[model samples]
Target chain A: MISVLLIGKGNIATHLFEAFSNLKEIKVTQINSRELDNIPNADITIIAVSDDAIAEVSNKINNNFVVHTSGSFAMTHLKNKTRKGVFYMLQTFTKNKKVDFSKVPFCLEAEDKNDYQLLEKLAKLLSEHNYNIDSEQRKRLHVAAVFVNNFTNHMYKIGNDICKENNIPFKILGPLIDETASKIKTLSPEKAQTGPAIRNDEETIKNHLNLLSENNKEIYKLLTKSIQNGN
Target chain B: MISVLLIGKGNIATHLFEAFSNLKEIKVTQINSRELDNIPNADITIIAVSDDAIAEVSNKINNNFVVHTSGSFAMTHLKNKTRKGVFYMLQTFTKNKKVDFSKVPFCLEAEDKNDYQLLEKLAKLLSEHNYNIDSEQRKRLHVAAVFVNNFTNHMYKIGNDICKENNIPFKILGPLIDETASKIKTLSPEKAQTGPAIRNDEETIKNHLNLLSENNKEIYKLLTKSIQNGN
Candidate 1:
């Protein structure tokens, strides 16, 4: 059985607490990041707090195994004398959204063999997608997440803005959005791409540019140039 | 029975012909655009050739009602002497990938009410998603599609490139990609936006820029600035 103590009341921590509590072989305890004075003992102590608070919070925890959930922060940042680790889930955790934990990739790290195995065992219980990613690799994944998740959503926002201005319903693009996301699984994004940029359809490109407002026009031009250069 | 003639055996025409031929109410005939000399007559003639060939192909069809399946081309561009219309499907059609007709948004346009009804009836026979979209709105939709589908996939390509360089399996980011696409279906992309750029976390942004290649660095900065300015 694994006893886990999670610190932080934010979205990531709350989601972790709930997920851990559901497993029969796990005993989970949660506490706010501010209330670290009387921190409970556990086999695994996870600090799922903000990036800025990670140092201060880890400095106070005296658990046998200390891990932070920050993608950017390294496991060595943990000030505890016993051991250090990282249990970063490589997916965004929203407050009310139901996360399919089975699909969430758990990027686990530890200094010693025993602690690494323990974390791996716990991760295996939650998800099949477990990677022994070190700090350097985690840093790469973090930035990639920004492009595929956050920046990709921004593209959708611009599309929505265009639809709104033209009195077209935004949902008309739902199937295309889903297809774009799923296509990468089978075909690499580089090969799956299709549009004016890739085809060099200058006439269509000019026509599309005339339809866009000032803000997206700048974006439209830059991305087009980038795609052309890369491809 | 409705006699439907489809010109051009490209991706869109092939898919449409397959869909129409499956229905018992529709008698569909497909011929290559090059074989236009022996043009068949039908109640509805669909010239699904390339955008450049749309005018020449439609000019040859002597059917009662004629439609071209080009999103950027206006319905009035069809030189059919009898009647002109459009049957634009707002989803990307790959050669081998199966298309879900029910989810495809059929943007139909016609010169008169009777022609519009006939197209609507045909669209309803194949799929539930039918709209009386004009040339102007379709032009808006075409540009919006470029943003949502084409540009968005480019972001995924950049992310994949980062993963390849770091030896991180690109599939590790698959769930995150699916979630990002699905999240926008419920929340507006404006509200759905997250990550360092939206939060104005300069430290994380700087770190992310350091990880990207020289090609994606410019893209990262531009998208980051755009997200900040818009949000």
Candidate 2:
């Protein structure tokens, strides 16, 4: 059995705790970040905290196998005298949603081969998809994630605002959003991209810009220019 | 059987032809836009051509019930002396992809009540999700779609570019994209929003901006500002 100690009380920590506790082979203990001095002994201590708090929180941990769950942070940020690693899950966790961990990609990195194997084993228990990624690669993955998840959701917000302004239900655009996301699974995003920008439909682009506010018009022009440049 | 004539060789027309052809109750005759003079008489003639071509193409039609498939174009743009209507499917179509029309939302409009009923009946035959939306609402829906479909896909493109530059496989972000899209179905986009901008984490936002290129940096700043303003 693998004994794991999870730190932090954020979305990722809560979800990880629930997921780990559900596994018969894994015995999990979760605690809030403020109670760092009362750290318990475990085979691996995983710190799932905010980016700004990762280094500070990890410094309080005194464990042989200490790993921080952050894609953007390097493994060296753990500041643990003992063995250190990263068990980062590439996902956007919400408080209320039940995440299917099997679908999530786990990016694992460690200072030692044995620690890497331990993180990999733990990742396998939760997810079928795991990658042996270095810190640099993980940082890049996080940036890509910001674009796909954060930026994409911002686009949905813009769509919702437009629907509200026009007195239309925002749910009408839901199917289109799903289809667009699903298409990229099979086709490259560049090839999957279709719009007035890609088609160079200046009239439609002009009309759309007319409907948007000042800030949105700036965004519309910049992204349109980017898409037109094929970058 | 509801005999229909679909004119256009574009993505929308082709997909509509394939979907309508599968139904036993709907008899669809599809022809290229150039063959408008040879248009056969049918219960309804659908001009699924470009927005610019809708006026010129529908003018040639002599059918009693003529409609153009466009979200932005108004029902009056049909220019048919006969009864005119609009059948706008609110979803993106790709040339190689086989779209499941049942999941697509059909926005229907007509000048006459009987013609509206006829369009609604045909929409029901093609899709389970149908809405009785007028030209004004349909125009707003089109703009909303540009945000959700076109703009959202552009985000995917940016993510892909980031992954490519970092030597990472773009498919890794697929699950994140899917989840972001799925969450909006149940929760409002504003509530579902996450990341540095929403959290007001200036530090992480600065780090992300530093990682982005000059053009991407502009986008990052603009979107961050928009999200910060809660617009």
Candidate 3:
């Protein structure tokens, strides 16, 4: 049985703790950042704190193998004098919603082979979709994630705003949003792309622009231009 | 049994034809737009052609009840001497993929009460998620869809581009994309928003912008600003 120590109490930390707790073979202990002095002795210590708090939290932990659950941070961010690795789950976590770790892509990184195996074993306990990704690749993945998750959510916000302004139910766009995301699984976003921008339907584009607010118009124009330029 | 004539060979028309054909109570006859001269008589004729072809195609059909399936076009765009209505399915249609119209949101509009009921009945046969949306409301829904579907897909395209440039598989971000779309179903997108921009983490935003290309940089900055401004 592998023993694990989880640091922080944020969304990622809470969800990771719940996911780890479900596995019979893994024994896990979770502590908030304030309880740094009581760091438990475990096979692996995971710092699942905020990006700004990762290094500071890692400094307090002294374990044989240390890992962080941050996509942007490098393994070396853990200044602890021990084996370091990253156990970044490429997903967004909400406090109330339960996450199925099995579908989540875990990007694991470690310098030592034994440490890598340990991390991979632990990751496999939580998800079947784990990968051995380096810091560089994980960093790129985080940026790509921001576009897919954060920016994409912003587009939904814009749609909701449009719906609210027109007194239409935002729920009307739910299935369309789901379909848009699902399409990318089978087709490349380039191939799945369909809009006035792709067709270069100037009249429809103009009509849409007329309906949008100034800021939305700017976004619509820029994205339309990007789509038209085949970006 | 209700007899329906579908005009168009495009993605929406084909999918509508397949969806309607599955129902034993509905008999659907699909014809390509090029065969407009041989328009068939039916209880209701639906012109599911391109937005540009909707008017011209509708002009050829002499059915008592005529409708065009377009989100952007108004019901009056159907220039047929017969009764007019709009049947807009608010989902992205791909040529090779089969769409489960049951989950698709159908926005129905008609001037006459009987025509409206006919269109609504047809929509209900395709989807349980039908709405009796007027032309104005449908127009807003269409614009909102552009943001939710088109703009959101562009964000995915950008993410794909970033992953390709970094030599990381774009599929790595699939779960994140799916989760982002799924979250909005329960939470408003504004409340669901998260990222460096939303958190106002200038440092991380700066790092991301530095890694992006010139065109991507512009989008990143614009979207970041939009997010920061609470739009």
Candidate 4:
């Protein structure tokens, strides 16, 4: 059994805790930075803290296989570590519900081949459902993720608010919302894009704009122009 | 059985054809402009044409309780005609599938009391699984949908492109995407917004900008500024 030590109690760490707890072949222990006395020596020590806390905490742990769980942070952030790597889950995390890490993509980064092999095996176990990625790729992926997930969801929020203001049931847009998401799976977004803006239907665009509040109107104008010019 | 004459063969009409086809209580005769020769005289005629075409088509139909399926276009668009009303489906429709309109929303608008009751009954029947909205409210909702459904989905597309170029599997953002969507159902978008741009994490934001393509960089900057300034 691979013994793992986790440091942190945030969303990602919590999910990791639950996942590791259920794993039959892994023995995992969590360390609270606030109560460092509980920390135990283990085969793998994972620093799943905030980006700012990585270096300070990495320095505290003496000579264990250390890995940090961050996509944006460089692996060198764990400089004091002997067995150094990254165990970044390339997906967002939330606290209330359990995440299916099995399907989640794991971005594994390690300097030594043996360490890489160990993390790879651990990642693969999770990979029965999750994806196994690496640091360099994880950074790129994280950047893209912000665009699709974070930014897109924001747009949905805007849509919901607009519906509420107009007294149109937000449910009216559900199918379109779901379809927009599903289409990207089969087609490149560029190819699947459709709307007054993309069609350059200035009349419809103008009508839609006239209907918008000042703030929404600004967003509408900007996005319309962007999509029209193919930016 | 209600004999319904369905006009237009665009996205909404095509789906309506598929959905209404299975209902035993309703007999639908669909008319694409190309199939105008077969326009059936029936109890009700639903003009499911483009916004610009609503007036022209309403003028062509003679002495039937005619309703145009448009959210933004007011009832006045059908003003000159007798026995006029609006049967707007407040949901987005695509050509590939039939959505369960019972759970969707149907916005009913009519001038005459008896026709209004009939329209309301029809709407109630369809909305057994959907929502019922008033025209004024639906128009407002349609505007909001422009923000949430159309605008948000476009942002997702843009974000996905960023991932594609960066060799990141866009799938990684699925959880975040779903969470963002699900969150707004319970919270206002402005309150739920989280990210480097919102927090003004200058270091991370700068790092992200460096990673983006020139076009995406421009988008990142524009949207980031918009979100930050609440413009």
Candidate 5:
């Protein structure tokens, strides 16, 4: 059986706890760092703390095969230990939704061959629910995710505000929104791109800016200019 | 029978052609500006051109109840001597897919009461296929659309690019992306917001920024700051 010690009990940690606890041949001992003394010793110590606390949490663990669950960070973040690795799950997770790990990609990294082999075996086991990933590639992916998921969601919020201000039913835009995302699944975004900025329709763009709230107008102009520049 | 003269052969115009052509009382005629002088006179002219071209195209029409199929632009853009209005379809149109405009919102605008009534009748005909919208409401919805449709799609593209750079299958992120958008159906985005930046985890944000490519790093930082600032 693989004994796993999980540190932190927040959103990501909770999911990891639930996932690992449900698996056979895997025993997970979850610990809130605030209550670390209660945690049982284990073969693999997985630190799931915030990035600033990674080094601090890493030093507290005295075990082989210590790892951290973060996509952007390196295995070196766990350098104080003998066995160090990464088990970063590259998917946006929420507490309410049940994610199928089988489709999630686990970005894996380690300091040495033995540790790499051990982490790879664990990753393969997890791969029953996720695809195995590598660090360098995952780093690039993390960046792209920022653009697509985080920034895009923010735009949605902005759009909602616009709708509320204009007495328009935001639901009216739902079908169009779904179609926009669906198109890119089959076409590259560069080809799928449309609208005033891409069309270079200055009049419409100007009119759109005019309709925006003063602050949003600034954001609209910035984004429009960015889109126009093709970045 | 209503003689509907469709101008411009773009995405929106094509969809309008299919929808209006199917109506019992509507006879649709599509004309490209390249062959402008050849078009026959009609009761209604739908100028489904780019926003910048709406004014120019409306000026060329000989005589008719002209309408521009743009949500952002006002009916004033249609400088036609005869009746003028906006027949804006408040939905995103793609070339590959079929859309049912019966429930899709149609924004109606006109100078004269008779012309407005004519559009209202036309809108009622479309209501069988979609929803009816007015000019001011549609403009607000259009701005909101920039966030939901255009901005969100761009974000997905970013996520795809991130996955591509990391040697990870972008498909892995698809389910999560879909869920994020779907969550809003029940919850407001303000309450639904998640991720490292929203948590105010400066360390994670810094690490994520460092993980990105130089250009992407700047984008990540800007967006992270924006989210943090609540913009």
Candidate 6:
């Protein structure tokens, strides 16, 4: 059985706490980051706080195994005198949205094989997807996450804005957005790509440019150039 | 019963033909865009040929009602001396992919009320999403589609490139990509935005910028600014 003391009351923390509570092999205790004076004894100490609070929170923990749930922060940065690791879930977390933990990719990092195996064992109990990713790789994965998640969401925002300006319902683009994401599962993004930018249809491209606002025109031109360069 | 003649053997033409062939109330005949000389006698003639070929294809058709499936092409451009309309389907059609016709937004336009009603009736037989979008609005929607579908797919391509470089299996990002698309269904993209860009986390943003290549850095910075500005 694994005894876990989970710290922080944030979105990730709350979700992790709920997930761990359901595992028969996991005896989990949750505490707010502010109430760190009395740190509970456990097989693992997980600090699921903000990126900035990770170091300070880890410094206060005196557990056998200490791990922070951060993508960018390295496991080596943990100030705990004992063993250090990372328990980063690579999916976004929201307070109200119920996450399907089984699909969430748990990116685990540890100093040694035994610690890595322990984290892997625990991760398997909650999810089928787990990776033994080190700090350097995790940092790169986080940047990639920014592109796929943050930047992609920005594209949707711009699409919504364009539709709104022209009195078109944004939801009309819903199926296309879903299919765009779904297409990558079977085909590589390079192969799945479509539209005038890739085809270099100058007439259609010219017409599209005239319809955009000044700010969007800058974005349209830049992305068009990038897609053409295939970078 | 409606008799329809579909021109062109392209992706959209093939998909529409397959769909229309199964309907009990419709008799659909598909011919190559090059075979416009033998004009088929049908109630509605749909020229699904290339944008450049729309005028030439419609010119050969003496059908009572004619339409072209080009998003940017105006309904009045069809040279069928009788009546003209547009049967624009605002979704990307790939050769191998099976499209859910019910979800495809059919943006129909016509010169008169009777022609509009006829196009609407045909659209309703196949899809639940039917919009009476004129030439100008259809043109705007097409641009918005470029943002949501084309530019967004580019983001996935870059994300895949970053993962491939770092030896991270791009499939690990599959769930995150799916979630990002699904989130916007319930929340507006403005409210759905997350990550360092939205938070204005300069430290994380700087780290991300440092990690990107020169070409990607340009895109990352521009998108970051756009998201920050809430555009």
lDDT of 1: 0.90
Each candidate's DockQ score against the native complex? 0.83, 0.82, 0.87, 0.49, 0.49, 0.88
Give the proportion of true interface contacts each model preserves, from 0 to 1. Answer: 0.86, 0.83, 0.92, 0.53, 0.56, 0.86
The CAPRI classification for model 2 reads as high
lDDT of 4 by residue, A1-231 (tens): 899998898877878888889989999888786666546888788888878788888887774688988878888768664778888776655547557666566777788888887887887767643445666667777677777656765676667667666655566676556656665665666776766777777876777777776866767887877788776
Candidate 2 residue lDDT tens string, B14-79: 999998999999999999988766678999899999899999988888888999999888898778
| B212 Cα displacement, candidate 5 (Å) | 5.7
lDDT of 3 by residue, B1-231 (tens): 889998888888888888888899899999888977767799888888888988787777788998888888988778899798888889898888989888998888888998888877888877899888888888878888998899899999999998888788888888899899899888888989888999999889988888888888899999999998988
By DockQ, the best candidate is: 6
Between prediction 2 and prediction 6, which has the larger TM-score?
A: 6
**What's the residue-level lDDT of B174 in candidate 6?**
97
Q: If chain B of candidate 3 is superposed on the true chain B, what is its TM-score?
A: 0.96
- Residue pairs that clash (backbone atoms under 3 angstroms), model 2: none
Candidate 4 overall Cα lDDT vs. reference?
0.73
The Cα error of candidate 4 at residue A5, in Å, is 0.9
lDDT top scorer: 6
lDDT of 5 by residue, B1-231 (tens): 778888898888888888888898998889896577776888888888877677887887876688888777777657777777777776777785777776576667777778877877877877743445566777777778877776676667667766766677877666556666776666777767877789887766776776665655655676677788887
**lDDT, residue B106, model 5:** 69
Minimal lDDT window, size 10, model 6 chain A: A91-100
RMSD of each: 1.2, 1.3, 1.5, 2.7, 3.9, 1.1
Residue pairs in collision within model 1:
none
Model 6, residue pairs in steric clash: none
- What TM-score, computed on C-alpha atoms, does each candidate reach? 0.98, 0.97, 0.96, 0.90, 0.82, 0.98
Model 4 CA lDDT for position A182: 62
- Give the per-residue Cα lDDT of candidate 1 at A76: 83
- Please provide, for model 5 over A149-197, each residue's C-alpha lDDT reduced to its tens digit, 9 standing for 90 to 100: 6677777788778777767666666666666666777777767777777
